[model samples]
Target chain A: MEIKQIAEELVSLVREGKNKEAKEKFYSADIISIEGNGDKVEGIAAVYEKSNAWMSQIAEVHSASVTDPLVAADHFAIGIKMDITYKNGYRAVLDEIGVYDVNDGKIVAEQFFFKS
Target chain B: MEIKQIAEELVSLVREGKNKEAKEKFYSADIISIEGNGDKVEGIAAVYEKSNAWMSQIAEVHSASVTDPLVAADHFAIGIKMDITYKNGYRAVLDEIGVYDVNDGKIVAEQFFFKS
Candidate 1:
């Protein structure tokens, strides 16, 4: 699949609360996600755990969208503006850009940046 | 040139206050550095300006080293821990993983992370 399609699909699954589908679509077996915060979840299982914890706190992922999406070879990157509204009407504003390293149709690694 | 060599050289130039050499070595004619803090310096010239401001406030960049440096095709990325010591003895500890999207041998896009 084209990187654009992959990126959109993966993010869609995530925002739609399709956890299993998002993980299966977005990551490789050995995918490495370097958490933006030092508390990275190491591997896939850990990612799931952290994600579950997040879900436990928040009702859902409010929205995930990107702009300035650029693709070079096997990498796809974009600037993102997100709102993850919590259960209590409070929201966290995240302005970031994510870079995904893809290989053989799967994302093998990802890095995220948070705006200060 | 190996990305490892390039990463080390570029970072060294930045740390050593060799602005000209570092800029010459790492960026293209139209490089874009997303301020990691949202005040992105759109082009190479802007990058130099923001960087200058940083240096003006800080005494020096203490160190830059990467672990798990990886390269596939035209991209390079790694985890970083840095200390920027200010003239006033205050310091900022930046623990980040940067993913660089290189094109035609130059880094066109760079995303940075800050661990919470």
Candidate 2:
């Protein structure tokens, strides 16, 4: 798949709440995931683990949105926003930019940027 | 200035190699900058120092390009690509995504994402 096609498909799956499916379909096994706070995780399994840890803390998701991908060369970025209440009763809106690098039709690296 | 206007003006100044001017005009005094390698700097003076340090290491800039801004809410992102030769005689292409957050018509934070 082309970079744009992969980017669009990932966005579509994410919008439909099939995030895990999107990851399985597009992310490479050796993908490197970097969080906004500078934590780095390698491989798809680590990424899943990190993601699951984050999801487990959310009590409710009031709203979620993702902007269309801004494609440039082998890189693409999308803005993501989510309003959620945490298990600890804290509520806030999470706004961030997710940047991805594609190689051979798979996402090899991903990074998130947000105020921290 | 509106967020979109600030974003556009910053991009324009950066494309013309007037990064310091752009920072002076748009960035807040307490602005925060986060590099892809997890380095963080605060305040306009710190940002200028960091920028100067990076520039001091570059021998020549073969080419540079900045993509159009992708704006969403109080945030905007732009893709940057540069082909450069370093003082150490090494040459490579640098590609990155610069994401910025605007507050009260000033950029409060900027984060860069790139493979490190």
Best by TM-score: 2
How badly does each model clash, as a count of residue pairs? 0, 0
Off by over 4 Å in 2: A1-5, A15-18, A28-66, A71-75, A80-96, A101-116
The residue pairs found clashing in candidate 2 are none
DockQ of each: 0.04, 0.25
Docking quality band of candidate 1, CAPRI definitions = incorrect
The residue-by-residue lDDT of candidate 2 on A1-116, one tens digit each, is 99889999999999999999999999999999988788999999999999999999999999999988887677899989999999999998988888898989999999887766
**CAPRI category for model 2:** acceptable
TM-score of each: 0.46, 0.72
Q: C-alpha displacement of A57 in model 1, angstroms?
A: 33
RMSD of each: 14.6, 4.0
